[model samples]
Target: MAGEELKPSTVISLADAMQAYSAGRYAEAEDIGCRIAAVHPNDPAVWNLLGVVARMTGRQPEAVACYRRGIAVAPDYAALWSNLGNALKDLKRCEAAIVCHRRALELEPDVATSLHNLGVALTAAGRDGEALHAYDAALAIEPANENVIWDRALSRLRLGDYAGGWQDYEARFGRDELPKRDLPGMRWNGGPYAGKTLLVAAEQGLGDGIWVARYLKRVKALGGEMIVECREPSRALLASMGVADRIILQGEPLPAVDFHIPQCSLPGVFTPDEAAIPTEPYITADPQERARLAPIIAAAAGERLKVGIVWGGSGTYASRADRDAKLAYFLAHFNIPGVQLFSLQKGPQEEELKALPAAPVVHLTPHTADMFETAAAVAELDLVIMTDTSVAHLAGALGKPVWVLLCRVPHWMWQYGRSDCAWYPSMRLFRQRTWGDWTGAFDEAAAALQMLVLQRSGKLLTV
Candidate 1:
């Protein structure tokens, strides 16, 4: 004991580093991980902890490198392989991620996490059938896994299994990221609401609210006075739709109601048959707002067909990078001789429009006031062309001719393998033939637009 020395301050054990990570002290975890990696370079556990810390801190490239190092040290380590797969999936390298996940499963079969990760990668790669199987396998192992349930629901919805999908979709309310609302009223259970006031609470994104608001009319018909709550930006737009007897902004004190339902839950409750799904638009802009914007848009368009274009949605969306197309693609493709394209895009991505070469495109996003104002502007347009975004839903809800450019695997509402949306009769969908192939979608859209222009000019009878 006379010559014995205590370990250096920089020395850290794998257990200590993991404890720091579990406590959410990511910076400390990263420091400890780096120290451990330096001294015990060949230790797979040290490299794995370093990778997890890097990923948690948004250093995905570093995470990938660390995971690879860990795999090199311990090739048969299933957890290391699975972690690498998750990092690759986050980077949108789904094919590579799928390989990693499969290798992880090969090393250790019957791992629920590996199965779930494999499902996610498969789904992102546009292999919904395989993803569904992976999810089912995961569910078999751990029946109450919320993440797996949610992913399986999305896979089901993508395959157009609405009945089962919507039921599993309820798991979102249980997810920590989307906390369940603690409202005063009783949660509605599809019971008769005759003579009872019902409050429909908003959930998820504005686009989700717009999409599900269609169900309000059905709720209104169920013989109840309905009150709808929405975000402030959407309050004016939802109010104009006239689907509810009263509309309130989120966070406001609510009036007494006999029953309440999250807006998304309406589908599960109503279970509208495929044929019963509403095809007509349920929302419109104020005529005064439309009248006000029509002349302004008409002056900009002259005699050319006015086409409103939105190339992106909110940048904060997890999948926006995949769903959004370059603004240049629209400028290059929508250059038909007799058509004028107006930029209906909002948010930070609108800056990209300024970099485009001189074209017959008018920027209207600057003048748009709110979602209602956007609806007013969309109403003035002869056609609206947009990627998956709120504007697409707004244009469709206003009953305007809208062409939606879709990613290879689009949102659940769009379904799959269809050029027409059941939710919006006036909407036409142009899907990517391959993943991330916006050019193909744009080319098809251009051809459709040419036909639309001919139809408008009386050269073609129908489009």
Candidate 2:
């Protein structure tokens, strides 16, 4: 279509493939695109469409191959270059992706979408300053693009520019991919809303609710009775915080309130700088619940350094690859002589323990029903060691000693280049020095655990 003419039948087939792709029917699109690529190997459009479909279907290697073939046929095609860049980015080949994106821009400099994709690849590669500059360029071209604004918000937050970041973070609502609640009431923007009841509905995941629960107390101080609506799993934990005047679980009838706000947006209310963030433990396990779970833990631990471990987060998370590790990997490294490992992991990942030759850790997931119960079990333990999951937030909130293993590029909240968390003072972060490599992080954690065991037994002297 760019400069060459195709047979009427071929053109019709290509149009059909494009329509199928737009309808989210990946199978239909891929079939048509594959047929066309076989018949018309000389046309870059066929390969480009196939590449796009491959990327959508999560076959990143196939997508890269398709894009490369298309680029070979039509070296000047900016779309082919851009698509190749995206596929390479998905494969975590950031340097190659950056080169392809730059070539795309060279061919078509004014294309804002190309710039936005470039920014994403750059951010993934940890060149955040350059990424921000690219995002700024894209925004200058299309100021109203919500997706660009949302990404820019993440970069700004990662850089610790909380005030500016929160301002742009509001753009999240404009993107359709994120969940939205059409609750009954005007959304609370900020400032004092005296004498009026406010409903703070927890958004995203369980970890999100725990992380933002710290803001509820401050919201209450803004002169209104605050109501917290969270997932059923977290109701008890939220109730224990005593931050909200009333607590309601999700799926229940909405209580009448004058104003409603997403729990995650609470930070935007004050636009708090780093120093203003509440670092103290604001959540606790129910004392009664903790007492109940203590004996079970003590009987199993038998004076060894009691440690709880979670090797994975929720599978639905987009960046789970970077954030999660294999359960076998943890078992391999954490086989310390004087340490007792307890499994606090929930979700389908808990099944990974069954495939093991024998139970390496004490299975506590059976005793722990929800986040609150998990917290009680965690309270009885000497320490919690886990990947970045909801339990990490729970332990941190409880003021328990926690070691959080992180990927090279973690979430914006974890920020960049620090061994300790500002949000959780008791948290010690063990980050992977190389992308996709957890050996260094795991080895360091193993050494630290051994030291902890020694210190507890008075075998090692501490200053």
Candidate 3:
């Protein structure tokens, strides 16, 4: 529908554009929005809508231009300002977005959306205190609003307001429709399903599965034969959890059960008073896996320090912009002492890794099946360093001494201002000092590597 030429003389012809956008035809939305913006060059709303379409279609620069054009046309339009702010945010232009949001609020004082948005932009820029105040302002107007509430909660958590944060975090379920146990209805947290079958299925990502698997033990503890299911890639790892009586892979419809519950929601269902995150590293690797790979690793003489490394996860483009590190951050210490850093690279970061020198890296890339093989190789590693990727989880599961490079806005599970993973006691976190700054994380990690080298040689170096 966005492909249709603009037929606007007075009113904006945004109907087809909206339709194309809803149908996920990003290109079509961009085409129609562009045509409409060209036709009604004076209309700010047209420009704003065009900006939204362009942003969604991944043409970030065009989107920014569209927003600027709208502001020029209707400088007083608060909605246009908010729209512009979001576009700037999408482009990682937080300071500009902050200005736009502030202007929008000055024009429309009761604009809760603007406040909430301003808070997020500020949080992205690492101004947590100001962000909290902004979110607080938004929530004061619209208390029960889920988006505002969840966002505020995130800010609170980021600022270490765990008392308020966990309460808000508990209300997270009604916000989105995550993966669930595909039974007729939702999982029953009620006791004594003595004669009945229930599916406590895995929904969401592998990290989510690992986080949620904590409740499976309680489910099994209650005599519920919970069938834990996630993607095939995580089957081996998920299987090791003693809570799951049976591990099922995704795409295979599970057997009918009396009731179904998403494993992630167990926190909401069971422990409402306090979230004692069952965060001990329960997921483990097979002993046989360790045995099978020992010979292969033992052949590589004891001289070189084997290091397993992962650069990226399946992070979204916006998420990746902040969470991911430049390859140089991981590669700077490649020649530090005798460490041989093997590439456990996955997703889009593969091409970037290929261009780096091969001396430190061993590419066992996309073809590898299961974490066990990865674990098998990791068995030889003196240490592992990874961004918040699945490889970190794998190495942790295997009880490897892992140094996880953390983003400023770390994943929710990591909480705030912590350097070690409570989930995996063996894991340590090297955090970025500034938002999207990997330099500090790499520098700290490099220094830690130097200490580890000295320690391995039975020399305790003072910090």
**Each model's TM-score, in the order given?**
0.92, 0.95, 0.83
lDDT of 2 by residue, 1-463 (tens): 2223334587898999999999999898888877777778888998999999999999999999999999898999999999999999888899899999999999999789999999999998988788999899999999999899999999999989898799788788857757566886889987798999999986788999999988888889886888899998898878877778999888899988899998889887754798888888888788899888999999988988899999999887789888999998888888788888999988899889877768769999999898888889988998999999999999999899999999877888888889899889999999888689999999889889888888888999882
Q: Which ten residues in a row have the lowest lDDT in candidate 2?
A: 1-10
Angstrom error at residue 217, model 3: 2.7
RMSD of each: 3.2, 2.7, 4.0
Candidate 1 Cα deviation (angstroms), residue 275 = 2.8
The most accurate candidate by lDDT is: 2
lDDT of 1 at 150: 95
Q: How well does candidate 1 score on lDDT at residue 377?
A: 93
Clashes of each: 0, 0, 2
Which candidate would rank higher by TM-score, 1 or 2?
2
lDDT of 3 by residue, 51-115 (tens): 87788778888878888888887899898888888888776678889999999999999778899
The deviation in Å at residue 159 for candidate 2 is: 1.0
Clashing pairs in 3: 187-260, 187-261
Q: How much is 8 displaced in model 1, in angstroms? A: 7.6
Judged by TM-score, which candidate is best? 2
